[model samples]
Target: MKTQVAIIGAGPAGLFLGHLLKAEGIDCVVIERQTPDHVLSRIRAGVLEQVTVGLMERLGLDARLKAEGLVEGGFNLADGERLIRIDCQGLTGKTVVVYGQTEITRDLMEAAPSRGLEVIYGVGDVAVHDIESDAPYVTWTKDGSAGRIDARFIIGCDGFHGPSRKAIPASAAREFERVYPFGWLGILADVPPCHDELIYANHERGFALASMRSHTRSRYYIDVPLTEKVEDWSDDRLWDELAIRLGPDAAANMTRGPALEKSIAPLRSYVFEPMRHGSLLLCGDAAHIVPPTGAKGLNLAASDVHYACEALAGWFKRNDADAVAGYSERALARVWKSERFSWSLTKLMHRFPEDGPFERKMQVAELEYIASSVAAQAAIAENYVGLPV
Candidate 1:
């Protein structure tokens, strides 16, 4: 197979990039190691920053999202007993959309074919060759047969665990990371959210968050030790812990049901210095990862796709190498900001094992400042809603 650009991964970032490139009249193909069913079945965060929503609209893919997604105007920061509300719309004139990542992937997958985009799934032994040269090609195997795609550029949207990042030589990339001592044990249930807005709590025990995917579906999480296992948490036990951490009011109003999905996700902050090496460029989780505290993971992916599309389009249309040449730096600038936001939020909301009484007091003081000061709230709102792409 031959194409102008080859995209590795069928996640939202790759799919969105392919759709955007096709709209720009650029030929592109997506390669994935997972089946479409497997991709769509994975559960992920739902909060959509304003910019991400705008991109979906630009792609003519926001009808379902606009109708079904919950519009969140604000969120709450709680220090166990007291809740501090940050008015997102008031501070930034923007609101986030609560549309699951799975839905976004489904929308892109459904729209790809109609837009003349191509994708190959269930492949093995995927590798990149001659990425430093003007011409780059990708190879894989499917059903005991070898496959190859010769393209002008190869994009790695394959995520943190994917092969794309590993293909980049270690000498060409500088890695930075911080693995937190805790993880989030989350559950999805078919029950209305206890509150209209998401509530993030910093309790004596740990951290807890009350969120929702829709009007009737609730998603909640509690901070847990890295050594904890999901099997260690029963539905009843989890609920008891959540209610205690959420405080009196929310706990009293909270309803519980059988969990549809449950899992433990470790918190981490990771990034590669430059997102590009030769004709092989990385996007989204392939390049960096942020803790879920700031809800920046999927949003960052969308922004990366936007930048990639712009860079590729500029390269093909005007023979301008500037955008392509600077893609890494430009994308890294935004990525670092998000990482800071996620890191800050994580620190503020979670109780670290190393935190002394002084550190806990500091966290409380910071939350108090954010609650009392308009300037502080605005800063949090601006970053939470997302920085410009």
Candidate 2:
């Protein structure tokens, strides 16, 4: 196979980049190691920043998203008693959509063929070679046969663990990371959300969040020790913890149901500097990771894809080499800002074992300041709604 760009991973980022490139009349092929069914089975975050929503709109793939997604003008921050609502629309004139990342991937997947986007799933042994040179190619195996793709650029949207990022030499990159002490034990069920807007609660016990995928599907999470096991918590036990932490108001309207899916995900703040290494440009988890506190993970990926599209189109369509050379610097600026926001939000909302009384008091005082100060609220609101892409 041969193309202008070869994208690894069929996740939202890779698929989004492929769709955008195809729309730009730049030929690209996406490669994935998982089956389409397996890809869709992985549950992920549901918040949609404008960058994410706009991409779907630009690709003409927002029909299902527009019909099914819930539009929220604001979200809430609770210190176990009162809801400190950050009026995102009023403060920043913007709103976020409650739409699942899996849904976005599906939309891109279903629209791929019609848009002339090629995505190869369920491949094995995928690798990129000669990325430092102008001519780079990707090789993989499927059905016990080897395959190869020669392209002008090989995009590493394959994620952090995928071969693409590893292909970059350690000497050329600098890694920064902070792994959180706790993990979010999440529950997804077919029940209505407890509140109209998403709530991130900081309670005496720990941290909890009440979020929704739709009017009938709710997604809730509570921070737990990293040593905790998912199998240990029954549905009733999880719901009971959520009630106490989210406060009485949310608990009053909360609906409990059987868990459709439940799991514990460790939180981490990770960023690999210089997202581009020659012809291999990293996007999404391939380049960085943010805690889910501010719902920046998938949106960050979308922003990377936006830049990747711009860079690739400029190179292929306009013959601009500077566009490709500048991709890393441009993408990293926004990535670091999001990294800071997610880290700060995680620190404010979660209880650390090492945090003493002073730390707790500081969190309380900061929350109070945010609730009382419009400037503080506006800052939070802008970051929450997402900064300009």
Candidate 3:
């Protein structure tokens, strides 16, 4: 098969790109190693920044999101007994929407068939070939049959372990990574959320986040050692830990129920420099990852896609190569800012194993300042709602 672009992932990044390119009369194909069901089954963070929600609206994909997603005007940051609420909408004139990543993926996937965009799922051995050359192509195996797509460009949205990033020479790819010392043990339950808005709490025990997918579905997390396993945490034990970390109010209102999903995710900040290499450019998790503390992961991906879609559109629509040539530079500018925000938020809300009394005091001081000062709150609100794409 021959196309203008070959996308090596069916995740939001790739799907969004496909739709964006198609709207401009560009041909593209998406390849995925996993089945559609598997992709939808994976649980991910839901918070959508204004930039992301705007993109969804522009694409005519906001109907379900607007109707079902919860718009949160503010969120809370708790330090032991003290609660600091940051008014996101009041400070930045923007609010975040709580709609799970799975729903976004499903919406995009469902819309693909009607638009005639091609997505080959359950494929294996997907690889990019001759990316350094203008005549780039992708190869894979599907149902024991070999498949190849000759394309003008190859985009890697396949994520951290995907082969697209590795296709770049080790000498050219500069990677920076920091794996945290702990993980978040999270649970999804069919119960009302403890609070109307998300609450990020720092306590003597660890960190806890009270979040939700809907009025009836709640998602919560608490920090745990890297060695901790899901099997080690009973439902009761997890709830108890959350109550202790969340303080008196949250614990008292918390609803107990059987968890539908439970898993531990290790925190990390990772970025790969030069997001573009020849005809191959990277987007989303393939190029960068942020700690979930700031809820920037999916929004970051949306921002990358916004840049990429514009670049690709410029190339195909106007025969302008300047934006496409400068894709990496432009994307990295926002990527670094998001990285800093996520890293800062992580440090602020999480208890480091190595933190001494002085470090603890510093965290408390900063949190107090943020709570007391309107300027500090505005800055936090701006970053939280998202920087302009």
TM-scores for the candidates: 0.99, 0.99, 0.99
Steric clash count of candidate 1: 0
- What residue runs in model 1 are displaced by over 4 Å at the alpha carbon? none
Candidate 2: regions farther than 4 A off = none
Writing each residue's lDDT as its tens digit, candidate 1 over 1-389 gives: 89999999999999999999999999999999999999999999999997789889999999999899999999999997689999999999999999999999999999988999998999999998999999999999999999999999999999999888988899888999999999999999999999999999999999999999998999999999999999999999999999999999999889999999999999899998689999999999999999999899999999988889899999999899998999999899999999999999999999999999999999989988897899999999999999988
The window of 10 residues in a row where model 1 has the poorest summed lDDT is 163-172
**Model 3 lowest lDDT segment of ten:** 50-59
Q: What would you estimate as the lDDT of candidate 3?
A: 0.93
Candidate 2 lDDT trough over 10 residues, lowest sum: 113-122
Query: Which scores higher on lDDT, 1 or 2?
Result: 2
Q: Write candidate 3's Cα lDDT for 28-104 as tens digits.
A: 99999999999999899999998788878877889999999999999999999877999999998899999999999
lDDT agreement with native, every candidate: 0.94, 0.95, 0.93
Q: Cα deviation in Å at residue 250, candidate 1?
A: 0.8
